[model samples]
Target: MGSVQRAMRLLETVAAHERGAPAKQLARQAGLALPTTYHLLRTLVHEGYLRRDSGLFHLGDAAERLSRRVARQRRRSAVTETLAHWHDVIGAPLYCARYRDGEIEVVGVADSQENPAVGEWADFRATGHAHAIGQCLLSQLDEEARRDHLARHPVQSLTPYTVEDEGAFLRRLAAARHGEPVLERQEYALGTVCAAIPIRIGTIVATVAVSLPVHQADQLLPTAHRLQAEIGRAPGVLALSFSI
Candidate 1:
């Protein structure tokens, strides 16, 4: 364990130098003996953790891959925490979703026993035509992308309020104004209404949505507007590409 710690220390020292550093400088900085540093550097090069070029050591591909994995994990954790915070602030079930590689994915959801989330009785990906979250994400996509998605998942009446057919759904999507929340009334689930606002960050298509019971439908628009404003202030919540 002590040897591993020494090796990690050396690696960190090497990383501090953008142009790389020589063995003697690395040893002095890491407080390791000259001989110990040489031995550990040789082992690191062999294990693909470091690469030596012109007598200077630099981080290798393995170290870079590890860094990327840790960064992604941190971003995913932040997204989850943000969703839970928003759920408490909005007093409704909160959902965060995105369009990745032509598929709708619900990345994070926050709910509790009191204000429980809607049950996923049916698959969300295939039922994109019948929900505010899906419609909002689709609205952000270009014409070809939207048509391609509908081609794979044909429009169907999941409830009395769902769009009737592909043509009507296409028209509805076209008529939707940009930068406005997509609203649905018990279209995806019985006795539930939802509103979704796009979280437009570059090319990544994402949405932040909230759902309330049909009886409390009047709160949908105001709640959605609040969510939009909150999301705008903390754009980091969706600034990452956890999916694509």
Candidate 2:
């Protein structure tokens, strides 16, 4: 395979293995000969894409920095526009989120309507389990990737309404995979209801949703439909651009 392809494969291998794979194991998984794998890994390490700890390899600070940059870049003017559109149409707080590593991070938010309950800025490392954004993004992953992600970071209950059991969470994910939007009610915060639709690109990347208070959400079905329709029409524009 070409160097670029090999590098991508190596990254995937590293991502798939949670504990940081040994050099020999990474080489075997990447299908590269031992010597070539070692050389490629060394080069990657030098370039700040991979880090070596003791004898195992993991993503380096450079890789994390790049990921954050990409994620920030994904929050384009279009995303801001989308958030604004949702805010105006729904008349409630609207936010855009994307999944990174095993967590969901909020990259953009619009607050045309005031809600004392929801904060302007979301916690950076907050779990995705209690929101539609996270569920929709998780739905986009394949079975193996989904399993790997859940294995790395098991679902946590953030509220009384949150899915606290594995089977129920899997069922919800299955529904999301079938193109159903997940409605989370006071799962992340009391008195908040979130409706999320999978913003899909071709078949992989997902990024779209509008969260509002339950009363506000009740008035937002039409607006939400419009948002979902708009997102469906321009899935690639957001997914390809945002990637942290």
Candidate 3:
């Protein structure tokens, strides 16, 4: 077998043992000669992919990092596919974002030339009160979490229609009925209107949104409700929140 295959066999053998395996036991399990196994084990340990302790070997920190990196890539691919599918079905640019660690993050977006995405004239993260996506996410957070986020990215007017007062914004969020989509008009960007719906997966808060020119204002609420219904029917595909 090639060096990589041989190394993988050793790693698989080590992984099969819950308490770790001695060099001789690993060599037997991997079907490699004792000297070759020792050399491979030394290399693995030196490279930090395997840890040697007392006479046994175990998977190391490097292996954990590799696994996490692979998982993150897989999650990104899945999220991209989901967003693109919805964008095609809705005939508007679709956006997905999450509230993580006291901040808003726009994770994925899918748009086409016929239906271009909204321009980010202002930092979306800092203007949560001025856009549908951010407002939807903020509405899902608890009082303390909401307060914490607003403290850092306090309510500010990005356009003439933006909500610039913190108390008025908080009261508006409070009065919003559950599961209702949040709508904005020239709030974040002039001549653009948007709508967002909450995508709650357990305790995690996320949002799915769409933006269009002011001329399409009449279609905003209808599209938002349709998107909400689509999400309700197949929440598994709409939710991009993943375990890190």
Candidate 4:
């Protein structure tokens, strides 16, 4: 076998043992000569792909990082597919966002040619006060954190409908009852209306939102309700919220 194949065999053998495997045991399990196993093990250790402890070998930091990356990609794919499925079902653009590290992040969006998403003419991060995602995320934070975020990103009127008064905005946020989606009309964009509902998965706090052009403004809340129901049923796709 090639050196790479031999090395992979050794790695697979090492991974099969939870408590780690001695070089001789690894050689036997991998069907490699003892000297070849030692050489590959030394190289793997030097490259941070394997850890050696008292003559036993185990997967190392690099392997863990690779596994995490793979898991994150899988979750991202699942989220994208789920969004696309609902975009087709609801016939509107779908958006996913998260409140992480005190910032609003739009992680995924699904749209089609017939039902395109609203153009992001302005930076979403800087204009969280104006968008459904940002408003919904802000609503989930405690009063102190919410005030701190507003201090940093101060709410400003993006359009005529945008909430300009900080006190009024805070009151509006407080008024949104639990299990209700936050809705906004032509506030962030001149021609689009959106709605978002908070999603909590373990320690993760995120939002699933939908947007439609002004002509279809009446459908925003209904679309959001459908999205909330779909999300409630398919919680597994959101397990990677932190990864994105």
Candidate 5:
């Protein structure tokens, strides 16, 4: 890979580890030789991309600033505009979320109609198995990562419809990975049903969902499918995309 790509990769590696990984560990994880890793770390430390403390390297303040800048830019991205259009077309709450460092964060949301749960948008974090967006992103992870994530955060019963068992959760995730949207009825909330589809740049990278009252979800499926197709056609709607 080129120098810029390598540097970005190293930055991401540090961000992922968070606790300042050692040079040997960083080198092994990043597929670089010891000498190269040391040089890269030194350069990055000097350039304010990383910081060295007690022989371990952590992301510096500059890296955090860059991350916030990227998050702000993504909030204003074209994909978010398209998401708003989808929300308008469907008449339900639509959200765009991405998986970052083992958590799914809602980056964009649109709600034109008033709903009891619409305001919950700002509070939604994809860290729990009760969320459709979280499950969809988890479905994209490899087996080991998926298992580890589940172990770290076991399923909690949120409502009568919540999947409280590990086996069922895995089954639902498998179905979601096969392009089937997982629908939860009152699982996330008493009256809510959420249907989510994985969004990809090339494969699975994020998730977009339409959430509404359980009674309304059936009626909204057609509109949701139409919106989904439009999203699939929109340029750069996903973090990954297949070029035709």
Candidate 6:
């Protein structure tokens, strides 16, 4: 086996011991020579992936951090796969976003060259009031959080159809019911219409959105409703992916 693979096997043996394992014990479990095991253990200790004390080796803080990062990466991959699948199913660009750390974050987008995603004419983070994705995410938050976000990113018009009045926007948000889709017509960009649905994953405020040409405006609401129904029927599959 390669040196790196052998070293990893030794580390795995040490980890399985929980409390710790002596060099000789790890070598026996990993089928490696005692000298080789000692060399790898020493190197791992120096690299912070293993900790040695009283002639025994244990998994270290760096190993735990690496495990967490791998988990996060797997979760992100699942989310992207789900969005891409929906993009193909709905035949439109799909978007996934969240309201994290008091800012709008577009986590991922699924689009092709022919059916491209919306171009960022204005900063999405600053123009939340003008986009369906932002409005749907903001609607899920409590009034205090919504106010706080608007305080930072004041509601401004990105297009003539955009809602510039904060009071009117708040009223619209109040009228929206859970599970319904939010629709916008040329609000964020001309010649495009978008729809977003509030994805309730635990206490987090997240959204899934889709966009199409203005000529296909009639398909906007029906497609959005179809998206909602699909989500409802298979909530655990797509919605749980969003939580990750």
- For each candidate, what is the lDDT? 0.91, 0.70, 0.87, 0.87, 0.72, 0.87
Ranking by TM-score: 4, 1, 6, 3, 5, 2
Q: Show where candidate 5 strays beyond 4 Å.
A: 1-77, 113-127, 240-244
lDDT (tens digit, per residue) of candidate 6 on 158-242: 7899996999999888889887999999999999999998887776778889999999999999999877766666666555555
Candidate 3 Cα deviation (angstroms), residue 116: 1.9
Off by over 4 Å in 2: 1-75, 113-117, 120-126, 202-204, 232-240
Candidate 4 runs further than 4 Å off: 240-244
lDDT digits (tens) for residues 142-241 of candidate 5: 7787777778777777778879687888877766646666566667777777877766565436778888877776765565576568777764645421
For residue 130, what is the lDDT in candidate 6?
A: 93
Candidate 1 — worst ten consecutive residues by lDDT sum?
A: 235-244
What lDDT is obtained when candidate 1 is compared to the true structure? 0.91
Listed per candidate, the RMSD to the true structure in angstroms reads 1.9, 12.8, 2.3, 1.6, 12.0, 2.1
Instruction: Tell me how far the alpha carbon of residue 10 in candidate 6 is from the true structure, in angstroms, after superposition.
Output: 2.2
Tell me the tens digit of each residue's lDDT in model 4 across 38-73: 899999999999999988899999988987888888
Candidate 6 runs further than 4 Å off: 17-19, 53-56, 237-244
Q: Tell me the tens digit of each residue's lDDT in model 2 across 194-244.
A: 767765555445556666666665755565676777666666557755642
Candidate number of the best lDDT: 1
235: Cα error in model 4, Å? 1.7
- Which one wins by lDDT: 2 or 6? 6
Error of 1 at 92 (Å): 1.0
Candidate 3: stretches off by over 4 Å: 16-19, 28-31, 237-240
